[model samples]
Target: MPLCHLLQFVTSVVSCSPAELKLDNNGKKEKVKGFNVILKDTILFPEGGGQPDDHGTIEDLPVVRVLRQGAEAVHFISSALEEGREVQLKVDWERRFDHMQQHSGQHLITALADKMFGYKTTSWELGRQRSSIELDTASVKPGEMEALEDAVNNRIRDHVPVNVRLLSIDDPDVEKVRSRGLPDDHAGPIRIIDIEGIDTNMCCGTHVSNLSHLQVIKILGTEKGKKNKTNLIFIAGNRVLKYAEKSYNTEKLLTSLLKTGPDEHVDAVDKLQKTVKRLQKSNLTILRDMAVLIAQNFKSQPARGDFFSLHNKDGDNEFMNIIANEIGFQDTIIFLTVGEEKGAGLFLLAGPENVITELGPRVVELLQGKGAGKNGRFQGKANSLAKRAEVEALLQKHSCRRAAGEE
Candidate 1:
């Protein structure tokens, strides 16, 4: 009746030749001769649908890359063997096996979500280490997601047979086949992968012969998407084992650093944080007591008219500021202190406002420092205690000049 139906009828009536071709390592057309066998007509689908291409060896030589030329898939060989000679094809059994596990796992996950939540998978991808299927729904609740993950994993453990069948698009059986999506230009016979009792889809990619091949399915996480969609990220098979091993190693390292076992490391961190806070409080209390003692000692000093000096190893900028403020109210007190550590010194000059303005520059010049301000108050650092008397003498001379109105 319809053109598609007529074409399907004709295709069903005739079997198309298998397109697998086995070539020699030298890229020559050949038959089964060496361990490497390139197929003339192959069911192996080169990487598409975000899933990588299959990797294997033909006649023992590795197939490094599989590419598409028009409608044909080409398997590139590694070693250059005899040209124009036929070789036996060998697919990398491990890689092919893993791909099958992940692909089948993806179908189970998508199908379960569609059946339970009405979330149809819009697109899907099989990554190297992980896979994801995007659903038409925007979001799924965490509890609902947990149920979906459990359902899919249960299916993997069910060990259903994964069947691959080629049928014409126009066949009457096509009406009974429900597919997520099929390649639009796949006009002749279509490759359908049926996960018995789970899913049926048009796919050219290799899959495990049975569901038992996928030992496990682990949903790692789900992320939100635009246009009312969600991306389901997951790992399966040997990938799950590898991920668990890595996590175990990381936990071991952390436990060693924390000096605690795996189960206690988190509690150890919390306890250590509280201990640090308590010690910090005790240290602050000691600093405050020291500040008060220093302030009192400065007050007991005899008020001097010319200048006075003190060297303090425990004094810092804040400590010096407190002491200076306490002693500054005196009529004439030029307090100086050498800080305990390197790169520290303090000078506090206070006298008649006019006298300080005149002598401050002279004092700063002698100490090899530079600063200026109003009033008979000047504060700064000296290079060393040896230069303190020299700076004090300069200040005294300037004060005398200001008193004599010669400044």
Candidate 2:
């Protein structure tokens, strides 16, 4: 039997080497320094065969990671242990049992998928939340998935015995077992996982002793995979309960917010979205009409000033453009801004081409903004609309200076 098959063991440290391990924190990569210790034997399984490494403790020190290197399992620990020292090794049983359930569940699903539907499992992953098996087929229909789930759960209810068998590499039984091939440095007897009357595959990951231990398996759904393949997502054992609880909580929150029953959530949200769209359209129409009125009123002034300026706190670039178009930029230097009076907003300057070219850069600087101009129209976003009075003074002073020069 493999030492990993045991949950607790007394072992001697063979060697210790200090090393730095790079880990992904969220989306960031970080490096952590630790000691890689090889033990005379280990109860913690190393990462291999598509299953993650087991986490445990050695003499009360945390064993963070384990990896199989040739015939040895290297345990990465937070602190170094003296070589040849005897230590007590204990596996994190909860995590170990979870892996056992998921690994065994995967075997059952893979075996039955091949047997019943002839869907060969090309690859599989034991993910943190859920596990998946990639089938050679392009897709799995809902009906087929339902049937597959039913079949796997039936076997779980059957309480079938799952046995581990060891055989010589050259044994006839070794050839009968399903295998993806052995690692380059594989040694000792071949380890085979046998699901009585169900499957016999060569795997090094831990597994449950009985099908009943899987508790249950839920086929979540299917997702697109590589060319001509489909990935079937699933959750087994306690994960099924976790997923259900999360889904129910989400449904409850939506029901409360939407003020509708769970069944009516979709329709209620759809109606709310349509109402918002309608209101936005109406608001845009009103803003356009108001812009035209403001322009006409400014034009109606009997004694018109060279510069006409207006600011609408709750307006946008389109609103300012509408006002400028209605007033006509031929004669008056129109400085229209739409946004907060003392905060961020947008501004448009339209008049003489020479004036636009000269004043555009100044206006952008005063407004703490960025803008572009062509012909006689300049427009851009403004970050400091509070400085509008200073911009007005500058425009007035420049206009007066130009008029006097013309005279």
Candidate 3:
């Protein structure tokens, strides 16, 4: 198919066609029959300039990824497109303009940082909801971010006209640009983002042609970055409204839960947490006292050196431990197991080491469980306590055999 590149503004909606279509995974060359389209010429911006690509549609089919391959843009689609077919390329204007605001806002910020604070923006990234710039300085002082934002936002409110122009590498205005020279792989004409009187810089990302298009510039926060650099995280355009809405909703929820205004929510939460700790301590003491009372109730059950205690306590291992400790000190064997219908826990402590060594495995086997121990103290988990009564009888039966030494 014959192909030609479109000469259109960054915001233009393009009419194009598939110059050639084939299955092109990022690296895999398998013949997948879907998920990519290659347009002859498109207004959709590819991934570049610390900014991401635009996602829209080609002939109403969703275009998921727009990648820059040399001078051409490769469009990845959800469905395969036929060669030379008419396709209308549309840019998601809302998202596209969001990128424009952030990308252009970055240029203004980087320019002013160098102008006012001598801090340079070395690199940046455009993210789904947030964007950040890595500064050349070792660290940004706590107080400097406010001043940086103030200056950047002042420029945005001024509504400075922006210009995009193609220049030859030999043009004298090249020296007036910020940062280093053109990229090593510079192709065609050099594109410069000229921000009125604020700054001029080289960038491949699509940006708003006017500064006021960036509704606002807000400094979200900052952090220490790689190699002693500082990163300033920020949002622009409609995201400023979005970030504020989300923050307000969160604050509203916190205030409601704490039964206080936003100003006192933290103190309210602190008091609530302290009160919970006190209640937890009180409950633990009550459970221990209850366990002791339960031991007294079962202390008189008679057997031939055989003791069995079963309780369905929802796998409270600590309660099981307390019961075993209270009654297991006597001169007899004990299988104090607690559990529910699905599973159970066993804590075995016996007066005779040989008796437990022999009987513990059988009890575990009866319940289809797993456990191990020596010196007549064993602990394990079991699949079922349904046979607890049978298992209890087995313990009593084993005690009789062990006492008689009938092996």
Best by lDDT: 2
Identify the leading candidate in terms of TM-score: 2
| Candidate 1 worst ten-residue window by lDDT | 4-13
RMSD values for the candidates in order, in angstroms, are 16.2, 5.6, 7.9
TM-score of each: 0.55, 0.74, 0.68
Residues 99-163 of candidate 2: C-alpha lDDT, one tens digit per residue:
88889999999999999999998889999999999999997766998999999999999999999
Ranking by lDDT: 2, 3, 1
402: Cα error in model 1, Å: 41
- Candidate 3, residues 1-407, lDDT tens digits: the string is 10111322222322234343344478666543344455666788888778888877776777767877677777776565556666576668777878888898888888888898899888999888999999998877777889989988888889898888778878888777775555565577778888999898877778787788888999988898999998989898899999999999999999877779999987988999999999988877877787777776778666424465556464356766677677774456767666575455554445467777777788788888888877767777777877877877887776677678764
- The sequence of per-residue lDDT tens digits that candidate 1 reaches over residues 23-93 is 45576866532222234555445776556777655556566557655465666654444544455555565
What are the clashing pairs of model 3? 36-77
Model 2 residue runs over 4 Å out of place are 1-5, 279-407
Q: Count the backbone clashes (under 3 Å) in each candidate.
A: 32, 0, 1
Candidate 1 TM-score, C-alpha based: 0.55
- For candidate 1, the per-residue lDDT at 135 reads 87
